[model samples]
Target: MGIKSFQGKRTTTNTKESEPILVSDYMTRNLITFKEEQPIEEVIETLIKYKISGGPVVNEKNELIGIISEGDCMKQISESRYHNLPVDKNNTVKKAMITSVETIDGNMNIFDAANKFLESKRRRFPIVENGKLVGQISQKDVLKAAMKLKSNTWK
Candidate 1:
C-alpha cells in the first residue's frame, strides 16, 4: 500500500467566550522567503524542504512582491507537461506567483483572522508591517490560539 499523508481537518471551535489574541501571538516569525528572480524548480524545492504550502516572495529591497503556493507550482507543472516544455531557467517563481495577495497586520485579533479564514479558502496569511512581510499565520495557528484561550479561562 502507498503511504498517504493526512493534513488535519478543521473543526470549528466554540470560541464565543475565548479572549481575543493578536496574530503575532501565534504567528511563525522565522520566515522562509523567496526571491522573485528564483527559478520555479528552486521554489518547489524550497517549499518541500520547509514543508510549507506557500511562502512570500520578496524583491531585492526585502519588500513583499508576491506569494507562491503549491497550487501555483502544480498548475505550472501541469501546463508545462501538457506543452512538452521543460521547466528551464526561464520559468521563474514570479511567472507563477500570485501578485494580488490579501495580507493581515500582526496586531489584528485572532478572531478577525479566523473570520478571514472562514470567508476565504486560504490556508495561511502573511502578517505584514508597513507593507513588508514579517510573519505568517495559518488556520491551524488560529485554532491553537483559540484552544489555548479556552483553556486559560478555566484557570
Candidate 2:
C-alpha cells in the first residue's frame, strides 16, 4: 500500500474567527430583575409587561438570590383560588421564589449552555460573574446562536 499525500488544509490564520461561541456573546444584557423584598404582584407585573416568562430575583446589592417565574405566580394563584382566600398583597418575591438557582458563567460555551438547559428544563438562566448578575441566557438565545452557526457553516 502506498501513502497518499494530503493537500486540502487551508493556511489561514483565522483561529480567533473560529473560536467557540460563548454564552456571553448571545446573552441578553438588558435584564429586568426583581427585588427580593418586592411584592409578588410587582414581579408578576414586570414579567407580564416585558413579555418575559421569568426573571432573576436580586437583593439590594444587585446580587442574584433567586428566580421568579410565571409558574410560581400561577401556583400561588391556583392555591389561593382553591382555598377561597383573596390574593395576599403581603407576599414577597422571596416567599415564592426558588432559592436554589442554577447559574452559568458568562464564558461558558454555547453547547454547554444548551445541554444545561435541556437537563434542567429551565427556560432561562441567570448569567453570573464574580457572584453578580451580569446577564441572562434563554433557550431562544441558544437557538439564535445555533442558527447563526448553521448559517455561517452553510456559507
Candidate 3:
C-alpha cells in the first residue's frame, strides 16, 4: 500500500500540556523544622504537639542538614543501667538526626518524589526552594498525586 498517514505522523514530545506536578502545588503549606542544635526532646514535643511524623533539621543559616522522625526516637532505648542513662540533654538534634539527608525540590514531579521517598528511609520530604525550607510532603501527598495523574491522563 501507499505510505499511510500514520507512517509519517510525528509523535508530540511536548509536555506543556502534561505539566509535572510540583511540591508547591501539593506540599503541605505548614512547615515544621527544627534547629540542628535543638534537643531531641523538643523534637518529640513538637511531633506530639502538632501530631506530625517528623521535621527537617536546619543549621543557623537555615540550610537543611538532616531529618528526625518519630521512628528514630522510638528506636532509642538503653540496654545498660547507665545506657538507660539518657543521652546528654544538651545534645542537639543534629546529634540524633540522620545527618545524611535526602531532599526534594518543589518544582519536581510527584512521580520522582514518591520514588525517592519509597527508596529511602525517609517518607517525609522537605520541600525546599533556593535552599530555604518552604513546606513538606509525605506519602499521602504522593498517593494523591498518583490519583490526580490517573484522573488527568484519562481526561
Candidate 4:
C-alpha cells in the first residue's frame, strides 16, 4: 500500500520477486530483544535459551540502538583466547554491539525489507516504529514469502 527504502534499497514489489510484502504479514512480532546496558552473559544465555542467532539492542526508552549476534560473542570468545572464564564479565552490549544497526518500519513491505537484508549483511533487522522496536524480520521471512510466491499464494 506504501513504499519504503533503506540503504537506497526500494521496498516495493509488483512482479514475482518485486512485490512488497507488509511487515505485519511476515515479521516476527513475538521477537526477543535486549538493552544496551545488559551484560554479555545475558546475551549468551538469551541466545542459547531461545536458539536465536541474534536480537536487537535497545535503550531504556525502547529505542533501537544496535544489535548483538553470535558473531559478536564469537569475537569475544576469540579475544579471550578460549579462556574458561567469562570473557565479558563487565562488558555490555554497548561495548560489543554493532553500532550501525539496520531497521524497518511495521508498514514496510516485505519485498523492500528482503532487499535491504540481501543487499546489506544483516540476516535480521529490528522493526522500528517511530524509532521504537516493535518487531523483527529475518531471512526466514523472505523465504516464507518466496514459498508462497512459488505457489502463487500471495494475495
Candidate 5:
C-alpha cells in the first residue's frame, strides 16, 4: 500500500475581479437647490426647514453657479452688524455664495470620493455630469456604502 491517500480532491478557488462601486450608485439625486438671486432670509428659512447645512446655487438655466452655507449667512450677518444694517431681503445669495466651487464626477469610485472628503475636509461634494448638477455624494453616503459592503472585501 502507498501510504493510503486519505485526503479528498482539492478545488481551485475562483478569484474574479468585481466591478468597482461608483459614486452615482450612492449619490443623492433629488437635492434642495438655491438661486443666486434668492433672498438670504429665504435661504436661511429653507436651510432651517430642510435641516440642511448648505445647498448649491443655480442660475436661470439651472446651471450650478455657486454654493451657500450657514457660514456664508453668518458672514453676511456679521457684515450687516458691523455696518449697522439689518439683514434684509436686499442681501442675496450671490453676495454670500462661494463662486469657486469644486465638483466631482458621478462615475468616480466611492473609495476615491471618500479620500477626497478626507483631503478636502468637506462634508459633501456635488456630482456634475455634462456641465449640469446631477447629484451629490456625502460622507454619510460613503459610510452607508461601507456598511453595505462590510461582508465583502473592501478592495
Candidate 6:
C-alpha cells in the first residue's frame, strides 16, 4: 500500500520591485526658516507661534548658514542676565545660532537616516542639495514612514 501525502503544492511568482524609500519623500519642504540678522526676540516669538523647537538659518541667497534653537535662545537669556543686558534687538540669530550645522543628503535611505538620528541624538536633520537648504526630516517623520510601510517587508 502507498503512503498518503497531504502536502500542498507551492507556487512561485515574482513580485514587483518597490521603489527605494528616500529621505526626500518624507521630509517637510515648507519650512519656517530664519535669517542671521533676525532678532532673538523675534525668533523666540516665531518659535512659540509655530510651536517649533528650532529652525535653520539661511543667507540672502537661501544658502544654509546655521541653525537656531530654543537652547540657543535660553543661552542668550542666561548670558544677558549675567551681563545685565536686556534681551533686546541687539541679540540676533547669528549671535545665538550654531554655525557648525550637520546636514544630510536628500537621497539617503530612510533607514540610514533613522540610524543617523539615533547616532547623533538629533530630533531633526536638514536636507541639503546644490549647497542649498531643501527640506528637513525629523524622528516623527521617520516614524510616519515606518507606519506607512508597515505592510511591506523591511529590507
Candidate number of the best TM-score: 6
Task: Please report the TM-score between candidate 4 and the true structure.
Answer: 0.76
Listed in order, each prediction's TM-score against the native is: 0.83, 0.87, 0.72, 0.76, 0.87, 0.88
Error of 4 at 126 (Å): 1.4
lDDT by residue for model 3 (73-148), tens: 5544232225667655775676668877666888887888877887885678887678877778899988888888
Reference-based lDDT, residue 2, model 6: 79
Candidate 2, residues 102-132, lDDT tens digits: the string is 8998899999999999999999999888888
Instruction: Report the CA-based lDDT of candidate 3 relative to the real structure.
Output: 0.77
lDDT of 5 by residue, 1-155 (tens): 57555776768989888778899999999999999889999999999999999988887776889999989998998888999989876999998999998999888999999999999998888887777888888899999998877768755
Model 4 vs truth, CA RMSD: 12.5
Worst 10 residues of 2 by lDDT: 8-17
List lDDT for all candidates, in order.
Answer: 0.87, 0.90, 0.77, 0.81, 0.89, 0.92
lDDT of 6 by residue, 5-104 (tens): 5666657878879777999999999999999999999999999999999999999988999999999999999988999988866989998999998999
Question: Can you tell me which runs of candidate 5 are displaced by over 4 Å?
Answer: 1-16, 152-155
Worst lDDT 10-window in candidate 6: 2-11
Clashing pairs in 6: none
Candidate 3 clash pair list: none
Q: Once superposed on the true structure, which residue ranges of model 6 sit more than 4 Å away at CA?
A: 1-10, 151-155
Worst 10 residues of 1 by lDDT: 2-11
Cα RMSD to the true fold for all candidates: 14.6, 4.0, 5.6, 12.5, 2.4, 2.4
